[model samples]
Target: MRRKKLFKMAEVLTFENVFRDPTVIFGKWKEFFGNDNDIVLEVGCGRGEYVIGLSEVYPERNFVGLEMKGSRIWPGAKKMLAEERKNVSFINTMVKNVFDFFGEGELSEIWVTFPDPQPKPCRAMKRLISPRHLEMYKKLLKKGGKLHFKTDNTMLFDYGVEVVGADKDFEVEVVEYDLYSTEDRADLAEAKLVQTYYEGKFSALGEKIKYLRAKI
Candidate 1:
């Protein structure tokens, strides 16, 4: 029998209602989290592959997947709920307003996976891991916390590395040009993070997966 895809529908509040309005989440972080535990936040968590997988692998650490589209996020949210995963949660919110959802130094780790490349020069600001966004990530991540990134776009991969290198607060520890090579595949299997829908498709197409791990 084929293995079941672990996904479920999720009910989420509006972005403005949850993060912007003080009545919703303000002073209620503990209630949302339910305990004092190390937290990892995954931005642009499409279809919830990586965050859900990581939550299963690391039950002691809480995982929060933030995405703007409720329709795209519901499956992952439902999966976590169906699995009865207490350490995982989902947030439907825009990346531009991430600061509203998280206070300074509030996260143990941050993951940016397969974000839009935004090839046009005019659309450069929209790149998820741009210098401006990296600065914002630095504010929310704890000192020495890790930032993990994976992308199939070569230009975006190079740009991310350049941006991270220019930031004094971040130090790049791992840069893999091809993450799906046989050797690398074996390494990754030992501690598999999570694979998004796009990641699986791209890998099937033989597209190289670039990865970077950095400390802030």
Candidate 2:
């Protein structure tokens, strides 16, 4: 099993849609995707469930999955290749280096689905929704762009709402402590369009999904 995974990890970068060299596509995303369509990013996209789903739902918009683990990227890259999805791409890198691959206001939307939450106090800054990360996201997002955050962690959810709501630069458009509690609305429809791998596990364990939508 380990050998198979290692082989897949090594093969991840070989896919036509997977890019490890930021210089090759940085500031040339439209050329990379061969279209001027808006680009959306899914941070820490494990196995590429959300990105893949969104790509199917919104074919007009390009989708990129940013995940650090090459092994974690293997399955998604392989599946996308098999399906011949032209609008999807994968970047194997940490979120801190996002600027290396994208220019300011380059992305139309961003998604943070089931991130680690960086629960430790000392690792607070490591959280995807942390203030520093929010700044990075704000810079990368185009004017009128939006970011969607979904998680099952109560503490992280509250922290995101508090910090994002308090920030004067951003507007917290919607906050749902239990996303599945009601029928999906047009405002937050994408959050329920697909179930991510971890989201499925948490939902099966009777955990209520928390969702936050903020405009930058």
Candidate 3:
């Protein structure tokens, strides 16, 4: 575990990666990934297993996982480094600082998985899928880009859908309240389900997974 912590500390990226001026490097992702390709973000990417899985599946698209906790960011960063996957990277920063790093319409897609619901109404702003965060996502994603959300909490899923539906700019493209019980959702099952370790744990307990896709 000590060795693992050491490695995570080494891989965690900060302002220096973008020359300490995130706003200046906006829309210039090729400088970091070494190629001009679609960029995708996984917000609140705990353990980062799902985003790492996506980097493996979509070699042509660059994937960046934003995680504040170095310990949780370790496994995915270490694995990508060992595999020499240039398309994958991890950013150690707060989600609120996201705009400081990326520019408008710079990202192709975003994935929000198992984020804390911040159940209390007063703390709801802390939720990653809150209305504020959705607006932030709107500016980053390219036209028609999609935002995918998955969670085991029923309350969080319902809240996210309600927020998306109320927003005039976003359209709820898909909804799957019980993923396992649903049938023939090849669109979700085939590629969108980037199941992570946490997901497996919840599934083992027979929890039903909920999902929603919002088009921006």
Candidate 4:
């Protein structure tokens, strides 16, 4: 393994965070944060740009970046630890196994920032915003909790809007086909200012970042 990869194994929460017995973690999130603050999740949190950056913006709530790749999760995890951020954490796990960690009604919000669009017609189920993930999130989130999805892929953006719109269980709160167009919505506007590494690359190539906020 590389030096930085070694560092990630030693410093951040990896597979070790999950005990061999998954049942032991039932409803233990508040204890992990050492408080009952509202927890925010960033699924597929690549490089943890949204997790670390937004955790700073909203200190009262706790943030957890869920990513499978240790290398991709290393930078933000290290930075958060160095800064001594109490409200932020990361987990090395696949997005599909989210239920293995969190309990029902335990999460406040979920942010799926620039997730894989899975644009291929045959890969619709692979998209992060697919119904399978939505059903999973619905069980974890508190009543009226929010799920935010932002992406540069037009196909993914439209798919997410259609999925959430058709689903009566969730209400689409804010729909911004072009997130950077205006600072109209305070929360969404604040989010736009913090771009992830992938987002920056896409922005430079003149891609219009799309956004949608859904309440469940």
Candidate 5:
């Protein structure tokens, strides 16, 4: 497994659209994509499912997947390179360093898909939707930009909703404990459109996906 991971890491380094240096593209995302289109970010994008899927759906917009593990990002990065996708890219970095990856008000949307719950009380601040991360999102995302969260863990969902709801800077737009159970509508189309690898596994095991969207 270690050898396979090393190979994937090496292969990811060769992809033209995969970036290792966040400083290089800090405020030049439009120049990198060669367009002034709006950019969206997907945090913890395993295998780039959401990024690839959203790119196909919204070709007019650019999508960037941020994941620290290159092995998990190999399949998606390879597909984007093979297909010559211009609006999709991958960033090899941790979420904690996201503030340095993009300029202020640079992103139009942000997605936190099936992230680790960090359930313990001591680890609560580590969750992607924690108060500290929300502040970072507020700084990087444009005014009124949306932040979407999806997970199979109830505790995390409730915690996220509470935190975002309490923040005066954010307005909670949507909160669904069971995404698919509700009536299908245009507002929920994006979240309904893509199912990440872990999302599929959790759904198969009878877990109801929890989703929340907030505008900052």
Candidate 6:
């Protein structure tokens, strides 16, 4: 059986509507979690499944999902709107400009789930987990904040481990070679939390999943 929709997913919590006009997000943050500290951000939030699931599991923490394509984001946004989940919000924007939406040391956790592999050597620069993106993540995540990543591509996972390892601020740990292997399935399911549309399709065809966790 299919699971119930965890929370109302939002389509567009625009900058102008949420942050641009405000001097500080503290107030809005408080409104979501009357004095809580477990805020998390998800980049490239696709259909909002992971963010919404997280919000449902940890109601005290505020969750924000960022996505560029409105067409790809609408279902999750509509779910957020339908559920009226005050703790969750969706930003309709490109991942490359995430800093514009949040301030330094503002998040306690971040997730980069199933990002495009960009397998070509020359196209590697376009991959989401590159050195440049890690720098951007460092700006927003608090010291010791964690980055949890999962993908189906082994090349991308290996590349991410290499890049994050070379960065002084990030401590790479909990690298998994095959996330969905029978012995690792339970752990992967609990840690990864939710799956995206593409992930669902891939899993149906018996594709293996890979995952990693790192601290920044």
Question: If scored against the real structure, what TM-score would every candidate get?
Answer: 0.86, 0.97, 0.88, 0.90, 0.97, 0.82
> What lDDT score belongs to each candidate, Candidate 1 first?
0.77, 0.91, 0.80, 0.81, 0.93, 0.74
Candidate 2 overall lDDT versus native: 0.91
| Model 6 lDDT per residue over 1-216, tens place | 212222222324342223322334534665544566677988887887888888888877888878776555666666766777767776666877676667788898899988889989999878889988998899989989999888888899899989988999988877887675536455456466677876787778777777788898
Per-residue lDDT tens digits for candidate 5, residues 1-216, read 689899999899788899888778788888899999999999999899999999998999999999999988999999998899999999998988887788789999999999899989999998989999999999989988999999999999999999999999999999999999989799999999999999999999999999999998
Candidates 5 and 6: which is better by TM-score? 5
Q: Which residue pairs does candidate 4 place in steric collision?
A: none
TM-score, model 5 to reference? 0.97
TM-score of 1: 0.86
Candidate 2 structure quality by residue, lDDT tens digits, 1-216: 699878878899888888888988888888878899999999999899999999998999999999998899888888988998989999999999999999999999999999897888899999999889899999999999999999999999998998788877788898999998967588878988989999999999999999999998
Model 4 / residue 182 / CA error / Å: 2.0
> Which residue pairs come into collision in candidate 1?
8-78, 8-79
**Best candidate, TM-score:** 5
lDDT of 3 by residue, 1-216 (tens): 588676656655432331234555556678878898999999988888877888788899988888877767776676777678888877777899888788889898999988887899999888999899999999999998989899888888899999988888888888888876777766786234577777787878888888888888
Better of 3 and 4 by TM-score: 4
Q: What's the lDDT for candidate 5?
A: 0.93
Superior candidate under lDDT, 1 versus 2: 2
lDDT of 1 by residue, 166-206 (tens): 89999998788987563645435522356689888888898
Which candidate has the highest lDDT of all?
Answer: 5
lDDT string, candidate 4, 123-160, tens digits = 99888899888899899899989999988889889999
Q: How far does residue 46 in candidate 1 sit from its true spot (Å)? A: 0.8
Error of model 4, residue 123, in angstroms: 1.1
